[model samples]
Structure formats: structure tokens, C-alpha cells
Target chain A: MEKVIAGKPITVNEEGYLTDFNQWDEKVGEAIAAENHLSLTPRHWDVIKYLQNEQKNQVALSIRRVGKSGVVDIKELYSLFPNAPLKTATKIAGIPKPASCI
Target chain B: MKNLVILGAGTAGTMMANHLHHHLKTPEWNISIIDERDKHYYQPGFLFLPFDIYTPDDIIKTVEEFIPKEVSLIKSKIDKIVPEENKVQLTDGKQLDYDVLIIATGAKIATEETPGMEGEEWQKSVFDFYTFDGALALRNKLRDWTGGKLVVHITEMPIKCPVAPLEFAFLADSFFKNKNMRDKVEITYVTPLSGAFTKPKATEALTHLLDEKNIRIESDFAIEQVDNEKKEIIDYGGRAIPFDILVTVPTNKGDELIERSGMGDDLNYVPTNKATLQSKVYPNIFVLGDASDIPASKAGSVAHFEAEILTDNILHFVKGEPLTEAFDGHANCFIETGNDKALLIDFNYTHEPVEGSFPFPGIGPLRLLKESRMNHMGKLAFRWIYWNVLLKGTHIPFVSANMSDSGKHYEKALNE
Candidate 1:
């Protein structure tokens, strides 16, 4: 299915995960965040940027690795995304769902 | 030539296949294992799926990779087990006779037993993490979910991995806190037990963890039905607990084939001797893992321990000798307490979890009953150990099938 984000059309999987990473932008991130009832702050952007960069390198994201990434600690990451840190952060960052995620 | 047939190539059955393949000679005995599915799931990893601690690949493997070449692996669904005829009828109209039978069919989550549990809300708001699909579905729901009343519930006792629900609650607490929505989420743990856990001392320690995390507990909650339209779980006493998202451990019962065989208890678990692991009704039939009606916790650790005794007893029975080995129902589980910290609990049929160092008396690594980072690491490291060491039938260096009292501490009056 397709959803309009930031006046641009983006494709999503059956589970609502982004199907195309190239279509993602800051505006798209804002749209995703708004849907989840979250307002992305500077800290969320830091984690999102770090996650997007790590995804390019094909590294699996984990709570411990995110904490040690120097962007933010594990507690702060949880505070930013609440229930699903890697999932929400990656969703807004416009990366493919991490294979390590259920 | 004697035929030894094992049912359900799960944890207990797979381990038993390997254990016996090495012990029983080829010409004298033939061993075969049967299961409907071709995949073997690392069931403990199910708890981490919704939280993204583990992915599907990390917890699943092909069953053929684990079953040794000497043992025949039959992939077929069982229709019925005719114990009187000493044969098993398959769904495809095939039957296999067995001189010695091992029923390791294991237990399954019965979601349909409870009213409104599997209603229209199922997979939408009402979810379970017991199965692979359920965990994946819950993961999808959690991705975009805003904080609300997320209730972790247990339907009844004797479920596999009894401590898993508690682990989910702890992880949920950390999960919400990580998102800065801890204040928005109201976490409640509802159980049918009188305490936080089945045992006394462990309950005291775990109850404290719940209180420390500000998680509410509803004890002795016998759920009569789930009011899906209202999003409330109603108990037998007419007490109702409402939730926006309900994650439940549904009622667990043995495989339906056991019920068809007319050889199972009310819950479809085969009545077996707790120590010998032999079926109480049939001398030629044995039960292992979650299929057996043993008073032990239905955890992988208990199944591993039971495999040791059952393997020996099976040999003794074949040789027409007395079965001497006994199982003390040893079970050890790591309780995750969020924030990368966890607590280890070690106990058996008679003893509750206590405080002390494990494996050694004074100088040590792992601590019991106290939360520590090492325990969390140990819990994570177990995935590697399970695949490489446990399933391969290789003995872990320090751990034994039987619980030991060497390093355990007892209070002055409590000791007597």
C-alpha cells in the first residue's frame, strides 16, 4: 500500500514498514513520527541518523550497541521511542527492518 | 531388532535421539523420530522477539541439521496413537509399530479455550508471544503503538517457561522507559498464582522487582473471559482489569493425540513416574518434556534434566534391568529485570530459590537471587550454549542435571 508523506508518495509493506528506503527524507520522518504520536527532537534525530548510517553498513541494531554508539545511551534511546527503540527509530530513519527484529 | 519410536522432535525428543543414538547399538536397536514440522525453534528466544532482542533467523533452524544420520526423521502429522495395538496412525493413513515408545509431543497454547480471547480482537489488540507467528504479530503491533495500559497476563499454570511472562513485563517496562513514555504506560501483571511466582522465596524477590519498577500485580486472577469489546479481562469473581493491549500466555495443554489415545490426564499430559520418566500405565511407553505430567516446571532446563534420567531408564527397561536413576526436577532460569540486569534462580522439586553464589562457595562469578549484569550476559550467552552444547548432547562443564546444595545459603532457623 502507498501513503502520502510530506506531499510525496511512499510505499509500505503489509505491516506498515517502509518498503522503499530511497523515498525517505526528513519530512517523511516527521510524518512517520506524527503517526506514532511522537515529536522527533534533536536527540531522536541523532539516533535516527546513527541508525541510518549503521544500516548502510549492514549492522544489526541492539540496545547495547546503540548505548555504546556515543550518540545516546540505552536509557535515553528508550526514552525517545518508548516501547520500541530500534523499530521506531529505524522506521523514522527510513531503513529496512533489521533482520534481528522479530 | 527392536524399534524405538520417539514422537515430536522438539527439545526433549531431539536431545533424546542424540543421547540414545550414541548409547544404543545399531544392529540391536533402531531409533526413529517423528514430527509434523521441519523447523526447530529455539523457544526461549520467543520472549525476545517482540522486543527485537532476537530475530527469526537467530532462533530457528532446520530439523534435519540436528537429527543424527543414524536416526530416521519422519515428517508427518499424527492422527492417533493406539497404545493397545502398539502402533501410531498418521494422518496419511500410515501406521508405525513400536516396541518402545517415547511420547515427547510437547504442549501447545490453546487460545480457543477462553471466551473472547480469540475473538475479532485477536492479532489486532489481543496477542500472545508463545508461538512464532504470535510474536511476530505482536512485534508489528508494538512498533507504532503509543503507550497505554499494556497488561501481561497468564491464563493458567504448567505453561512452558513459566517465568517468561514476568520477563516480558520487565522488558516492556524498559521498553516504555526507553521511549520516554514510562509515565504514559500503565503496566500490570496478572497471574492465577497467589504470589509473583510459583515458589515462596523466589516470589518474594520477584515481587520486590515488580514494586521497584512500579508495575502493579493482580494475584489469584482466575480469568473467566476477556471482554473484547470493552478491552477488559473479567475474572471469576467479577473483577475486571482493562487493557489497551493484552499480551497473554494462553492455556497450555499436551498434544491432541494424547487425548485421542485415551492415555492422558485431564490436561492431556501423560501420567508418568516423576523420577523414572516412564509412563505409569504402560511399561513400554515413556514420556518426556512437556508431555509428561511431572510436578516439575515445564521449562527447557527441566526437559534437559529429564532427558538424562529417561535415556538411562529406557536402556534399563530394554535390558530387563531395574531403572535406578532418579530425576530431582532440577530447573534453573535467569530472570530478566530490565536495564541490562538479571537475576538467576536455581531450585528443584523441594527447595525454593535462595541467595548465594553458584557452582562455587566463596570465589565466584554467577550470583543467585541477586540482580547483576553478569546474569544478563549469562542469559544472552545461553542462546549460543543451547545450539552448540545443549542440543548436541554435549555436557556443560560445571552444570549438572541434579541440583546441588554446595554453595547455597540457608537461614539459621530456616535450615532446621
Candidate 2:
């Protein structure tokens, strides 16, 4: 579904996660972060950039991998986005939610 | 004759051996399977073992019984795979050259990965049910013991039989009730995921069941350490959960041989063409089951499905044809929800489990996403089928490899 974010019509899934990365920009990301009650600090941006880069490389993202990413440990990740850090961060980063498969 | 070597004579390798032996004739190909152990375990029984629902003899069988007599089975510890040279080195320094290699070395629990998990409290209070020894040890503990805080936890994902931990929780509820001590036991299921399960509909259904069974859920808990002194598991987020009996499914990783060979990702899972089941680094090598970094559930049913698609892909590669991108990550699992009832889920790469009838569409004797006694019967019958049909690559009568969407409720899913 298309919703106006950052004053642009952006396509998102039911959970407000971006369906396409092509439509994502810093402004769009900032707006998404605000929705999750997070401010775009430099540290948060660094993690977001790292997540987007991993997504670009087609690497499956997980909390374990992110903790080992050197950009942010899991504790800092929780402190950054608070609840469901991976899901919330990925939402702001405009990537699909990390699939914690069955 | 050209050599086709299979590593790890587990579910995946044995099935591949059976499938290839029938197709790849002896005059043209020589098939050999290697594993260090002689005993083949029906791994699903590990869930029921702790509750005394199944005996050790029911799950344990000779590996050789299922392997085709025409195929060679070599029992040895594999050192490493020399991928470039297409050779496997044994611990004794012997090497076996192969034109085609199938890496079916499946995943196993690494209890050592977690701090204090195997510390002083190991097997006394802290336990894991992923292994046969662990299961039996837990069974003994549950025999005469009074219950307190029973934490059924998962350390990480991509674990073999992902639903086993939840099943453990459900079965625990029933077991304690049967022992006339239901109120004495406080069952708490802790997972790193946001909910009881991954898929939305299944999670919703399972969450409801957890509520009904009075099993408390502690979600999004990324465990950091098991404090033996305090008897509590502390997470990275500073959440600590105390338990009298801690049952955790530790981080599951592929065989250490994959790491030794430098052919795997961070978790020692091989990088493969998820569709074709062919190794991304080498064309002649194929990986299936928990060994490959395919985003499918690492369950026996998945391996069974992959074996079917992989068999055709291997044949195509041998005949100098393009590999078939046929594997759709199909997995069908029966979820045991305690009290002689289960919920059957059938899904694939692009689909979440939905509410519907299975195999027979509207006329199914089995229901999907709903609890039933028939599904429970299906779960019990699966053990016999695993030994008799699944290992031999025999197709189940009604169930096709690719998931059928005919009877599923997808219309409701599309809107979500």
C-alpha cells in the first residue's frame, strides 16, 4: 500500500516496512524513525547504513550478525531502538524485516 | 566408473544415497556414503523422550538397515572437504576423490557457544534436549523430581526442528498434569523472536494455545549468559529470567568440518544456490538439509523434499544440462500441541501457513492451522514413515514435493 511519508508516496507493507528500497532515502528513513519514537542520531544512522549495506549484498540479517557487525553490539542495538530493535531498525532503514524463519 | 561421494550418512545423505543408487547405475557410477556413527536416530523422538512417550529403542536403529545394499557405506570421521580438488580427507589421512559431492553434514547444537551453559550446573539443572544423551538425561531428571520454574528456551534460530522447543513446553504441561502436579510446575517459553513462532497466522494460533495451556511466554530475549551461581539466564538487554530447570536449545551450527574446510558462512552453513541446491563456489558440489544456508526450516521433512528436487538436479548436471531451479523451500511439519492433538502446517518460500485442509483440499482428513487428534496420529505415524518411506526416498501417497495452494485460505492472506 502507498502512504505519504516524507511528503512522498512510498510503498510499504502492512507493518509499515518499505516494500521497495529504491523509494527509500534519508528523509524517508528519518520519518520512519520518528514513527517508531526514535531520533536519527549518528550512531543510529551508522547501524542503519550497515543494515542497508548488508541488505544490498543480499546477506540475511539477524540479531547475532548485527551484534558482530562492529557497528553496534546487541545491547547498543536495544538501547538505540528499544523494543524489537532489529524489526524497528529495519523499518527505518527501509529494508524488509529480518526473517526469523520457523 | 565415476565416483559420487556423500558425506554424513544422516537423513539427507541416506536419502540421496537411496535416490541416486536407483538412477545412477553401477556401470556408470559408484556411490559411497560416509559417517562416523553406526546408529541412525529418529531425531523427532527426542521431543517425546523426556516425557517417556517413546522409548530409546523406538528411535535408535542401525544406519545400515536403511542404506541400499548396492551402495557402499564407509564409517569414518571426516576431516575436511578439499573442495577445489574434489576430494574428502578422512581423520586417518586417507582421501576419497569424487566427481560429484553431496554435503549433507547436518546442523548440531553447540552448547559450548553460550557462557556458563556447560558450567558446574551442566546436566544437573541446565540441560539441552537437542542431543540423545541430553534428552535421556532430562527424562531421568523429570522422573521423580518436583517441578518449579521450567524454562523451555531457544538461544538462536536456524536450529534443526525449530518447533521442538515449543513442543517440549506443551508436552511438559501435559506430563506434569498427568503426574498430578500441574500447579507445581510453572512453564515459561523464552524465545528470541517477537512471538511464539515466525509466521503470523501460526504464531497467532500457537500464542493462543500457549495461553490455553497456561504457559507464559518471554519473547525477544537475546540471552547473553547463564549465571550458574544465580540460577538465572541474563540477556544482552539486561533481562534476567531465573529457572529451577533450564532447558535451552543452544545455537545450532553446521558441522565443524565445514568450518575447517573454510567452505561455510559465519555459522558454518554452506552457501548454495537456494533454488538449485548447488554450491555457489563449486558446480559439482550440492548441499541439502541443515548444512546449506537455505532460508528454509531445518527439519527432516524439508530434507525429504530437497532430496527429491536435488536428485533431478544432480542428474541434469551429470548429463551436462542446466540444473533445475526446482526446489521451492517446501516444508510440511506436524506441530504437537499436547493432549493428543496437533496442528499441521504446509508452506514454501513464498507462502505463510494458512488455514485449510491438506492433500485432499476440502475433503482432508487432516486440517491445517487447527488442532486435531488426527494430526496427532499423523505425528506418531511419521516415525514409522521416516524409517520405512522417507529414508528410502519413497514418495508419500498424497503429499507432493511442492506445496499445493488449492485448499489454503490465501485470499485473507493477500490483504494482510
lDDT of 2 by residue, B1-416 (tens): 99999999999999999999989988899999999998999999999999999999999999899899989999999999999899999998899999999999999999887899999998999999989999999999999889799999999897898888998999999999989999999999999999999888889999999999999999988888999999999888788999999999999999999999999999999999989999999999999999999889999999999999999999999999998898998999999998999999998888889999987999778999999999999999999999999999999998988888898899877665
Clashes in candidate 2: how many?
A: 0
Pick the TM-score winner.
2
lDDT against the true structure, each candidate = 0.86, 0.93
Candidate 1: the clashing residue pairs are A78-B178, A78-B179, A79-B178, A79-B179, A79-B180, A81-B179, A82-B179
TM-score of chain B of 1: 0.98
Tens digit of per-residue lDDT, candidate 1, span B188-282: 99987767887767788899999999999998576768998999998655679999999999989999999998988767889989888889988
Model 1 achieves a DockQ score of: 0.01
Each candidate's clash count: 7, 0
Chain B TM-score by candidate, in order shown: 0.98, 0.99
